[model samples]
Target: MHELVSWGRVRLLGEAGVQAGNDATTPAVKITVLGSGYVGLVAAAGFADAGHQVQCIDIDVARVEKLRRGEVPFFEPGLREVMSRAIRGGRLTFGTEINAGHRASEVYFIAVGTPPLADGSADVSAVYAAAKTIREVAEAPAVVGIKSTVPVGTCDAVQAIVDEGARVPLRVASIPEFLKEGTALADFMKPDRIILGVADGEAERVLRDLYRPLQLSSERILVMDRCSSELSKYAANAMLASRISFMNELSRLCDAIGADIHAIRRAVGSDRRIGPQFLYAGPGFGGSCFPKDVSALAYQARQAGVPLEVVEAAGRANEAQRVYVRDRALSMLGGEVAGKVVAVWGVAFKAETDDVRETPALPLIRALVEKGAEVHIHDPEAADNFVRSYGLPVRCFENEYEAATGADLLVVMTEWRHLRNPDFPRLRTLMRTPNLFDARNIWTTFELGKSGFRYLGVGTRST
Candidate 1:
């Protein structure tokens, strides 16, 4: 068993004035990141920006070409700028495959996607394929770090694959990412903690060296066994998801008892143990990480004969929350929305991200359409993505008021910065009916009621 170690203040050879992404003292290392998805692309860009020569590899020819021209395929704050700078500086490159010329990397990061399967277990086939490719192309000894969130024993299985047909010794380490979508660049630059699951000293040393620049103030690297590191990622996401689900469950109670969730959340979050984070009750917890990771953790536990009841309950509650939001909207529309014009503001799961993988707005919009309601939607960044992903009959507009024009009800699903404060007077004039459903609870009931609009918020008294 590898001992869990926490190093304090790593003393590097040249560690003076180490700024994130601009550390000159850190020696540049050649890195080959497999996969160009969210996690992979972010890792590739972050490493290159941190004074490392990075080559991001992906199977998609179109995506690779787009990345070559410095066109990021997704919306992430500050990602395009960082990637552009690295590309211009000749430190970052993109490729479709691993070749003989790309064999000099001392560290190889497998940042492929391990999407959840039907049984709620993660499908690590992409991860295994990346490992196989790295094993085939590794001419010198290299550390293969798994940045993909995976099962507990996935690293061991990958290690076995690398050891099968290896020209040189290859080490497998679990370096699971804990990045959030909107704040990915900042998260990478100043992570709360970096988990390094390594069996050998070489893997740990190389990964530590690569991540040393980011730990200038204090050491935030947590070194542990591979299984523990892999499990930690799932556990962290599960905990956050549980908090949101718990609050959502309470939101229903608040609605029933006419209690304000904002007041309750403030009182509950004031406790030192439960700081204000993920405590707000919204439509539901919908994102790539929380839902999938929670379900995957529960599934893995059940397979091991130890089911995580709390985690399982969190997933069920999330599903229930989506239904509750849809049902509440229907209730507000008098249970018969056959020809009502409903304008939905904010289709993305959260602000600043175009990812609609499991956005809460999806179910609500689908339910509205099924109920014969004409849904018009608007999002600053995610409108196009939402339209492409679901292809619903809803009309998508560039402007929020345009979506709300001639609408009976305006439902605010996402809490984008611009959607927080709207021209209520203009909204009332534009809409056929002055009904507003503040699903995100961004608007105050008193203000909306004073604006001569009927308003309903999550876990707040309806006006």
Candidate 2:
């Protein structure tokens, strides 16, 4: 059996926000996922792992070929193993198009990317294209669940397109994804809550049956209107971003008053009202979700003439934090680091994933290069993606030891687990001058002063 026993009812109580219930498994159904990006691939693999026959379609021919060999293009923890198992068991497959063979699937999931446009609005052309293809090729009646992050009313708009085009009866639902990058597979396998935006009972029943395996232990699924479900995703991301910005702003005040943010965060977060999740005061929030969602939410509000002042302020604060981190690092080197060799540790936005969409490290690295500092960067998995995004001239190292060698300063951008406890003695001996900037505040307990190193931490200026 491909049953993943790791997700138990005990772990699902607070995290999944549901009480333990009786087991209710449904018959396995054929599923097709449009797009092979983060959301599509994870959803496909996760469904297949849950005993569903899943077919994932993508336009990228090369990417499909790679997956056929049980190789994942991006870095996500535990996804490759699950996907390989599903493929070897003949339950999961990939292709470049949705043809006659795929029409037998009862449910189709649209998990394509909705990239932001110049005005911060989500360019949903890819979503529309996927919908158009589904409308043209679906031979049998199917429920199309949109797992893409889209603006409000997107589901209704796509439904209208399918209504006018499709010959067979079709139902459309908005099922926005809440999977975090690093733990996307886990997030999908065991979600906090499954939001199903359906117009009628038929669509609801279809999705509920498809998700019976996940809901067996607890019924955490929530059924709501399409527009509300669409807005819920944006609101959740904005709220999380606001929390980070609020903490970051407080961290600045803490620095000015000679108070430690670490202490304040603990005291404040201990309250039941404000639990400690995204409350860490760091170099600000980054990755694929927060930045884009915040911008999109703010833009949507402004377009409607009811500006989201709180979200807008959060965006400004986040941008300011980025600038502050960059300037602080430069100041440590006597305010002019034109000829210094600075080593950057952890380039991915966060740990456990290789997604560097809007990572704060990009701005710092770009500024360093512009100021003539020789940048030596290293990440366990994201260096190649980073280099591909910004083709700036810099030294990319395979190992942290190589990157930190002969460096005047070392900046920790992402809080990778392995980066928390490093060979400080070796790093001290390798570099010309020992200056450590902990942007993620992962080393708050470390005593760098006694070890002959100048340590700088975000929101806590000691050791």
Candidate 3:
């Protein structure tokens, strides 16, 4: 562990800066990431960790104040340590204001969220909001890059917006960001490849230089037009979703055929092309990305007169998986939900972060209520946000024991750090019924069985 910290810290100094030959085609430059949410904060820290100056700008004064205090507002393993190191080293700086950050930066990356609307289309208002601010502020010569996941032709629309408002000719660039919440810092520090989209020269070179630290010996930079890069973000999520939905559908069959998802995944992923990531069967994939991106893509396609049938199906499957898990939890209690007190731990989707934008827990909680079950919930950091989103109906608990106390069953939705190795004995004592619903299957399923508890897991019976 010490060696890992040392090695990682060494890489933090740009020790392995032997960028691949392909990067020679484009030049390197400085970066400013707008909107210090999940993507911007992690990306800024990663760049700063690699010995680069990054200005992280956001409109939220409270969040900026918290970050200034060395307090990362949410849970992210190792993020605080890395951000602290970078901030102290004078490589990463934060501000609620945008002008000071944008003017000094040679390349601007927009990492704001493109939330889904009530009709399921992406609400690109935030994306446009940032673009408008950048156009009004950017000093001297600069390339305005879109790091937010946007619909096709959004780049063109933003380009016009900037051109109309700018004193100088600011070239609009699209360098879509692809990152998972849990592994965001690592992924940004050492990306699989860097994608840079530009209308003409200079922008590509600037982006390539900004990410030169991660291009070591891989030539992992793909340069494309602005529109293609914008769509690539959605395409990537669509494909990853298909993989999850595929496995989720197969998990149902595995039960019928008496075949196990674990064994089947091993056999399938052995192909090298299939790769082992995202193959694990679980409640479903939910977070700020997959659900919204696919829904936006489907909406984008429909509005463009092109139908994304596969993406639409994948969205439906994801919704079903969430409902399926809750239903299965109820089924474990013999399909009787009335007067049932069900304890649920981990409301934030797939932990290491406190983002509950589209967490499966929302619908699952609703379902529990509709079935007449009194749901008791607990999460590490998202409880407050969850309560604000939907309250009075759900009884939020302070601790896991309190959540499980007098409960007919315990459902583990998110795989939080503390929840991994819980006191099973004490938990059993607290619960009215010791039914363990392991949606994530973090612990040994057989151990759950031997614990003198009724264990219901997502996939096959664990040994």
Candidate 4:
């Protein structure tokens, strides 16, 4: 974990009159972040580390108290250390409700969750609730920046809510968060670009000043209309998901032809137009962002009378890819998963985060269980979260080796670095049957066949 900002450095800067904008001339501003989830807590801590006073508010009182003591409920690397340092620096605080202190702040950021509804549209009730709270408590004019992932025109809707019999002028801006999980802190501290969707100049200036510390290296802030900014968040995630789905679709063809998708990826990704990122073939794309964003975008497109067929197809492919993997794993067990012990190596959507919102492992495990396979799941960081997400009857193991013990087949889902180089010989010895299913293609070069194990990799030829 690179130390983005330390307590001593921030305290000394505060003493020397240094502020958030990276310009000593500007004064420090007070910031209040709503909903101490991944995005909110990270933004609050990053702001406080930049010498600004931040108060993070969450409706969950127990969660707030846990954060106040520097305990992060979820797994995020380097966040607890920075959050603790910010709290000790007297610049970061947490509370259950928005009080007068937050009302007096210069900026209030709503980073609440916009969970997907049954129809795939984002349920913006939390966003509206946060706006209402800010409206009721705010005594002074403040820029109400929305860091939540909401549908387009959400900022306008929030502005209307704040404008309804308001005592203070609230400038609504759609500052949708672009922080990725597992590296959220670093992404916040050193962002690629800060998208500020503002209706007016005041909202723009307020957000720009708040993020100026991160922009010292380059002018990475992109200012646009609120509607465009709101759509940009969904568009970005959908584009990434499209790339992933496209690759997964091609991977199926590669497997059918006995051609390696790895080489195909290199051949195609080198085209400069098609980048290498998100090109890796895996079970499917999942997490809190990709699935929900894709679904919401498709939903919004339908509502607007301009259906996004490509985006919807990508989502379908993603769902099908999960089923394909599950079916492939069952086929490896002689067309019957009943009375089989199956071990899953990684459960998180990807690696490095405990978020299991739409992890492929869940559906695969569920299908295996339904087929009467005894499932054992293991993940370095996401075991607890997976267990919570999946209240189903399955064995949760502390280590990968333990999970693989006595298993008829082992499946790799997330590509954790630690899963890259496992003791193949030991794994072969531990399993009841030496069957290795490399879903992420992490062990393609391991030559498991030489170790007396049958290896099956996605889009790779088994030796």
Residue-by-residue lDDT tens digits, candidate 4, 1-463:
1111211112224443224344554456678999899899999988988878888999998998788778998999999988888888777889988766556777899999999999999999999999999988877678899998999989989999988866778889888788999999989988888899887776677777777777778999999999999999999999999999999999898889888899999999999998788899989988888899999999999999999999999999999899888777777798768999999999999898998989989888998888899999989889888888778788889899999999999999999999999998899889999998999999998777888998888778875
Q: Which ten residues in a row have the lowest lDDT in candidate 1?
A: 4-13
lDDT of 2: 0.86
User: What TM-score does candidate 2 get on C-alpha atoms?
Assistant: 0.94
Which digits, one per residue and each the tens of the lDDT, describe model 3 over residues 250-287?
87677567777888888998889789888877788898
Error (Å) of candidate 4 at residue 315 is: 0.5
Structural RMSD, model 1? 4.2
Per-residue error for 344 in candidate 1, Å, reads 0.8
RMSD values for the candidates in order, in angstroms, are: 4.2, 7.0, 7.4, 5.3
Clashing pairs in 3: 27-205, 28-209
Least well predicted 10-residue stretch by lDDT in candidate 3? 1-10
Global lDDT scores for all candidate models: 0.87, 0.86, 0.78, 0.86
1 or 4, greater by lDDT: 1
Task: Tell me the TM-score of model 3.
Answer: 0.87
CA shift at 420, candidate 4, in angstroms? 0.6
TM-score, each model?
Answer: 0.94, 0.94, 0.87, 0.95
For model 1, residues 1-463, the per-residue Cα lDDT tens digits are: 2222322222222422123354344566668999888899999999888877788999999999999889999999999999998888777889998755457577889998888999999999999998989988887777889999999999999999998887777888999998899999899889999999999876888888888767888899999999999999999999999999999999999999989999999999999988988899999988788888998999999999999999999999999999999888777787779999999999889988988889999998998898899999998888888888898998989999999999988999999999888888999899998999988999964578888898888899888
